[model samples]
Target: MREDLTFTSGGVECAAWWYPAAGATTPAPCVVMAHGFSLTREDGLASYAEALQAAGAHVLVFDHRYLGDSGGAPRQRFRAGEQREDWRNAVAHVRSRDDVDAARIALWGFSFSGGHVATLLADGIDVAAALLLCPFSDGVPRVLASPPKTVAWLLPRALADMAGRHVTVPVTGQPGERAAMNLPGEADGFAATVRPDSRWRNEISPGLFATVAAFRPVARASRIGVPTWVGRCADDVSADGKAIGKLADRAPRAELHDYPGDHFAPFHGELPTRIAADQVAFLRRTILA
Candidate 1:
């Protein structure tokens, strides 16, 4: 059964959906999940939630504070620090539930939220497992890889954001346009990830890129000791494969799997099934065992 729910985080109400496992008697294993940058809980994450539920795991998918059905000031904010804290609160809320195994609470984060998972694991949150999908782990390399002009324009906006000036900007746009992601096909690539009936938007706080440039999770991967799974898109332009490989190499318990597409590959059509199967197998052997 699927139930709509909400939890208070940082004094804000965060919307979420709880999918209980079928035929589960005692508390079943649970996986806590959230979306990527500029996306919502229902956008392309429902399929994965269903997949996990079918594999005998309860799933909790939530919208971060400033977007979707959640309540927060200044809509469409993409602050990573706030989102990380939201994650901590989400896990804590789930741990208090009686329908799921508190000791087996795992985390699943895609894209930007992937970095959040690494940060949580580094802090030694009492999670049993974690799965990061095509993670945007290192910020310096990502911002540096952008076109010279895009970087030039965003630097000033970032500065203004730091000076107490908050504004919303396109999260994805065409080349030469001012946006957080503005490569040649970035707009289309991100659009392909959104599901129908989703409440997500293409705009977010202008300061997020600067915050991303300074964030460093891959460098801190060695500190995460959970049985983690890191999935990579082989030809991804959004996230660096080398950085992903390094992240897996540094983590003592992380297992890396490579798929055959870009950043959105694992979530596209039949590919998502393959990815989900891999995750189910991982859990079956580790947390679900």
Candidate 2:
């Protein structure tokens, strides 16, 4: 079953769905889940949360500061730095709960924010495990590898975003929607799995475009002491597989699972449920070992 959780961070009200374990009467290991860029808590995360919860773990799936049901000013804006704080705050909030095991906190991030988990680990979050799903490991390399034409159009807005203190860009659309990841195909793949009744898309801050240039989570993978599981798609064109491989190499304790599909397969069709099951199995071994 699922439940709603509301917590305050930096004076902003944030929301998450807590999936309680079956027959769980006391505190259980918790999985804190977040979505990728242009996505929200409703985008393929609840399935995973429920899977984990069914496996005797509590899953905390939340919307970021400016996305979904969460409270934030100037909605749809993306702040990489602030997102890191949100992750930290989410974990803290979960820790304070009586039904969660504070010492067995794990993080699960997908697509763009898969890279966010690495950043959080680098910042010294005491997490027990990390499950990354098609994460963009190296932001700069991934960004630079994009079509130069696309980058050119985004650079100006990126620059404007850097100086404006708050930047906004259409969440998804044609080629020029935003400079960050989620090009046309990626955007469409993400949109395909939404819950239909949710209003989870809009203009993300141009600040996200600017921030993408400076974010590099792979560089700090060596410092991520927690157990890590990276699930990648062999046919994923949105994220650099080589970059994911490189980050996996740097992680002290890491495992890589290559699936036979594109980026969105792990979140839709017959694969999502399988992927969620696999994720739950991975977390169980890591947290209970």
Candidate 3:
């Protein structure tokens, strides 16, 4: 069963969908999930949500504050800190639900939110388990992967945006375009996951770059005490494998899985079918068991 819902974070209402497990008993264990980067909950996450639900875990998928159907001002803004807070608030909202089992709460984060999962665990939040898929874990590696000139060019724009004279830039662009994540195959990867009715924006306020640059989710890996699973694509250009691996290794109970395809592979087509099986196996062996 699926239901629509909302919860407040930072004084803003965040939109979400609650998927109850097919054969769930009352107070089912729930997996709290959210999109990454400039993504909305509508962007091909339903497959993942459904997969988790089929495994007998309730799924709660939501949009971050200021994105998608959620409430916020000035729109299309990205802040790692605020998003982490949103994750915390989301989990709090889940606990408040009478239908959820607070003792079995879990988390699932995709792409950018994957890193956020690390932040949540780092903060010592209690959860039965967690899973992060194709997460962008480190900032310096991403910046180093981008063109030096583009990084230099964006610094001023980022500063300007922080100062409230906001400057927006395309998230991905051609080689010489003034964009933030304009790297090889980046545009194609983004295009592949966009659903037909997606409301994701191409442009975003750049002030978050400074925040992103300072975010090193891996640094807090050692603080996570719950069972965890981390999935990564071997050739993922959008993130650093070493960083992700190190984070997984640092987490005392983290398991890492490497897939063959690129970053977008798990989000589309037959690949999701395979990835879902792996994720379900993990949940069964760890949290849902």
lDDT against the true structure, per candidate, is 0.87, 0.79, 0.87
Q: Model 1, 1-289: lDDT tens per residue? A: 6899999999999999999986789999999999888789877888899999999999999999989999998888767789998899999988998988988989999988998899889988899999999888898888777988887877778767767777777888988787878866678887887778888889888777666776778889999999999999878888878888888899999999999988877767799999999999999987789
Q: Tens digits of per-residue lDDT for model 3 on 166-278?
A: 57888877677878878877777788777878878888889978666688888888998998899998888888889999999999999999897777778877888888899
Q: Candidate 3: minimum summed lDDT over ten consecutive residues — where?
A: 260-269
Candidate 1 residue runs with Cα over 4 Å from true position: none
RMSD of each: 1.2, 1.9, 1.2
lDDT per residue for candidate 2 within 149-221, as digits (tens), equals: 7677667787887776566655555555543554657667756767786757656766555567567788888
Ranking 2 against 3 by TM-score, winner: 3
Which stretches in model 3 have alpha-carbon errors above 4 Å?
none
Sorted on TM-score, highest at the top, how do the candidates line up?
1, 3, 2
TM-score of each: 0.97, 0.93, 0.97
Residue 6 in model 3: lDDT: 93
Residue 177 accuracy (lDDT) in model 1: 87
Question: Considering lDDT, where higher is better, how would the candidates rank from best to worst?
Answer: 1, 3, 2
